[model samples]
Target: MSLVIDIHTHPAFFEAINADEERLHLRQTCLGLYKTGAAPLAHIFNQMKYAGIDRLGLLPLDLTTTHGVELVSNAEIHHLVSLAPEKFIGFASVDPRRKDAVEVLEYAFGELKLSGLKLHPAKQKFYPMDEGLDAVYACCLRHNKPILFHAGISLQPDAPSQYARPEHFEAVALRYPRLRMCLGHFGWPWVVETAALLLKYPNVYADTGLLYFDSAREFYQHVFTRTLGQHWVDRSLRHQVLFGSNNPRFEQIRMVEALHTLGWRASTLELVLGGNALEFLG
Candidate 1:
C-alpha cells in the first residue's frame, strides 16, 4: 500500500478544549469556527484512519505575543509525538522575535527531539530573510530538518500580510542553498512566485494547502495550466510538490480526493500523496 503523509496541520490549536469547562465553552472561542468536522484527539485519529493517512506533520503555532494564543506549545507537541510516535511527527514553532529563540530551537531539536520547524511569518511579524533567523536556519541545516513557512496571506488580524510573500523567500533560499524549505499554501495568489522559487532553488519546495479550496478544474487552470502552465507544474511536482490537508480547516479525505481530480498519472499521484513528503522530511 502507498503511504500518505500530511505535512501541515494544527492539531493542537485548540488544546484548551481538552479541559472540561473549556470544552463546553469551545463554541465561543476562535476555534469554534472549526466545530463542524473538527473533533477531539480520538476523533481526529478516526478521521485519519478512514482517510488512510499513515503519518502527519503536527505543527504547533507560537503566536503568543501576536494573538495571545500560546495553546499549542512545543511541550504539547512533544507529548503528542511521544504518545503516537508512529503516527505523529512534531514540528516545533518559535517566534523569531524572542530573545532566546535560538536556544529554544536547540532545546526542541536536542532535548525535545522534534523532527522539524514550522514558522508563520505573518503572525510572527518577521520576514523569512530576516538576518536574525540565520542562527535558526544554521541550526536546521546542522540537524538536517526541514522548515515549513507560512507564505502568502494570513488569516490572523495582527498579521502584516506583506511579510509573508513568496518572493521574500528568495533571499533565504539563496543564502541557505541546502536548507530544505517548504512554502506553505503554495503562496496562494502568489503561486507564480512560489513556482519560480521552486525552480530557482533546489532546496525550496511547497505544499498544496488552501489552494485545494477551489474546484479541481479551477485550481488546475489557475495554478498549472493557466498561470504557471502544465509543464511547470509537472516539473515542480516531480521535484518539490508535497501533499497537505491543512486539516481542521479542511478534511483530509476530501483533500486526497481533490488531488485525484487533477488526473495525474499513477506514479505522480503516489509521489504527491506521500512520496514527495517522505523525501522532503528526510
Candidate 2:
C-alpha cells in the first residue's frame, strides 16, 4: 500500500494545561491525545508507529493572549519537529498580534526548517483576511511556504467570535495568489464555497481532516451511485481531496478503512491516501 499521509494532525504537544477543570478535560483532551497516540517531543515516533500514521503533520495552534485557549508555542513545536525529522512535518503556529510576528516566522522557517505555518483565526484572534496578515503572507510567499488555517469550526467552547467563516480567507488568497493556503477540515460549513474558490485560486486546496470519515465515504458513495452515476467515483478520482484523521478526534487507520469500504477507485484512493499530499507539499 502507498504510504498514508494525514495532512492535518498534531504529533506534537497540545494545550495540555489551562483547562478550568484540568483533571476532567485531561480525561478527554489531554489524556485523549494519548489515546489518539499523539505525544510530546519524546514519544512522537513511537506514537506514529502505534497509530500507523505513515506521515503526520505536527500542527500547532496559537492564542492571542486574550482568549484563554491553551495554545502551543511555536518554539515547542520547532523543537519537537527537529527531534524526529522525517516521520513529522511541522507547521509553526503564530500569534498574528505578537510584536515579533515576523521574527517568529523567520526563526521558524530559517532556523527550525519547518514545513509550513498554521493559523487559527478563532484561536489567534484575528481575521485570516485582515490586513494584519498581509505582511505574514508576504513572508511566506518570499520563502515559498504554505499555510494551514482553521477555517471551519472552533475546536473549543470559547467565545463565539472565535469561529471564522471560510470566506474570511478570500481577501488574502485574492491578494496573494502566489501564496499557498490549505484550508483545514475542508472549511466544512463552507465546503462548497471553498471548492468554488479553488477554481479561481489553484493555490488553494483542502484535505478531509476531521470530516467524520465514515460519513464522508457514505456521502461520496451517494454522489457516486445516485447523483453522479456509478462513474462518480471514477470522475472525482482526480479531485484534490486527501484523507486525514484528526487524530485525537478520530483514529487514522479508520480513515484508511473508510476509503476502502467506499470502494473508491484504486488510483483515486492512492491519490487521496498520500499521492496528492506528496505533490502538494512538494
Best by lDDT: 1
Q: What are the models' TM-scores?
A: 0.89, 0.79
Residues 1-282, model 1: lDDT tens digits: 589888988774434334544533432254333344325677667878888888999988776666565546798889888878998889999888778788888999999999999998987889898899998899899899899999987654556679999999999999998899999988877998898888889899898876544764466556756677766656555668888877766656777776766656777878877888888888
Give candidate 1 regions above 4 Å deviation.
13-17, 20-38, 212-222
Q: Which residue pairs does candidate 1 place in steric collision?
A: none
Q: Write the per-residue lDDT of candidate 2 for residues 139-250, one digit (tens) a residue.
A: 8888888888777775544424335677877888888877878777667656666666666677776776654435645754543345434654346434566666666565
Model 2 spans > 4 angstroms off = 12-52, 68-70, 159-163, 212-239
Global CA lDDT computed for model 1? 0.78
Q: Which ten residues in a row have the lowest lDDT in candidate 2?
A: 12-21
